[model samples]
Target: MESRFLGIAELTDVPDVAVVVDVMRAYTVAAWAFARGAERVVLAESLEDALALKARRPDWLTLKDGPPAPGFDLVNSPALLRGTHLAGRTVVQKTTAGTVGALAVKDASLVLCASFVVAGATAGLLRERACERVTFVVTGGGGRAEEDLACAEYIARRAGGGAVDAGPYLRRADASRSAAELRQGVREGSTPEDVALCLEPDRFPFAMVAGAEDSLMVLRRVAPVDPPPSA
Candidate 1:
């Protein structure tokens, strides 16, 4: 089995398994949402699709950009959803990179979303499944956000059987262009706290798997299987 890291622009051929990483916010929010007991999180490819889904199902929470709107219950902020009760509830999210990258890999046999929260388990799952070709897609904030690239590298390291301390990488991400902009907008909506929260590595033990549910890409939690004890 071979694994390769590719940015969105280089996604020419789909692999047997595709892992999309958007550590700055998107996948981190999903991890936190599930940790908070959300029934399931749906990944919307665009704002329009999220709104359209919300229009049809008023019970689902729609989270997007620019602070929580009056009618919207959430945004792409992990800190924002940390205290919210998501039990028995579904969240529909549309983000700039994560969801788009996830939906773009339509040809992969399996699709998973990765972040620092699930890095170890994600790697374990990949090796367990033994896929021949695995691709990690780094969905940068613009062309190649610094944070996402760092995250992609970190995930790749863990997947390739290496130890990773997220501290240094997280610090690098905090200094990235995306993190700087998010900090600059703290008063407007984006917060440094959210950026801080998303950088914590292996915070959760479960990996997020994405699949089509009706017209939405729904994410479900998958616990990585433990290996047999060494002889």
Candidate 2:
């Protein structure tokens, strides 16, 4: 049972478990939404797919990149979800690299989204499930970013039962090119506040599990518990 770290481009070789990380905003926001009481999250690879899902189920919350749409309740910014009531709600998340990486792991038996918010919990879940081969996929800024790589390293360490000093990695990530994208003018709908939220480590206490139920991909929270053995 060894856990390996990989980049977004090398997603062909899936492992027993694929842990996708998008620290800049996508997975961080998802973690926050779950902590705030979101029932389930649906990850969509494209904005069109999210829109189609939203059209069919008008009650589900849809989040994506760019400026806030007319009907969409929120964007991919973690700072915007504060104080919102998400209980009993389903959120459809469509991001550039995060959700796309998640959807690309066709060979993985289990898929989970990871961020600093849920790093420890994810590691615990993997141990509980006894997944021997795990791959930490850093979906870095559509190419490769320091933040995602740093997050992957931290997660790998935690999952391997090792104590990790994440300060240096987080500092590097804060100064990385991807962190700059969170600045107000760097990308549309991106805000400086998001950068602050994404860097906060261990902010949540649950791991996010992505599973297919009734042919629909869904994200659900995995609390700290002894999980059953891998299927």
Candidate 2 lDDT over residue span 96-163, tens digit each: 88888788774579898988777778877887787788888888755467888888777776666656
Which tens-of-lDDT digit does each residue in 1-231 have in candidate 1? 576777888888877799998887889988999999998988887777788888889999988867667556797888777989888889998887888889888568889898877877777777677756788888985537778777777766666665666677778888888787777775344577877787777788888888887766788999879521111
> What TM-score would you give candidate 1 relative to the actual structure?
0.90
Model 1 steric clash pairs: none
- Give each model's clash number: 0, 1
lDDT of predicted model 1 = 0.79
Off by over 4 Å in 1: 186-188, 227-231
* TM-scores, all models, native as reference: 0.90, 0.91
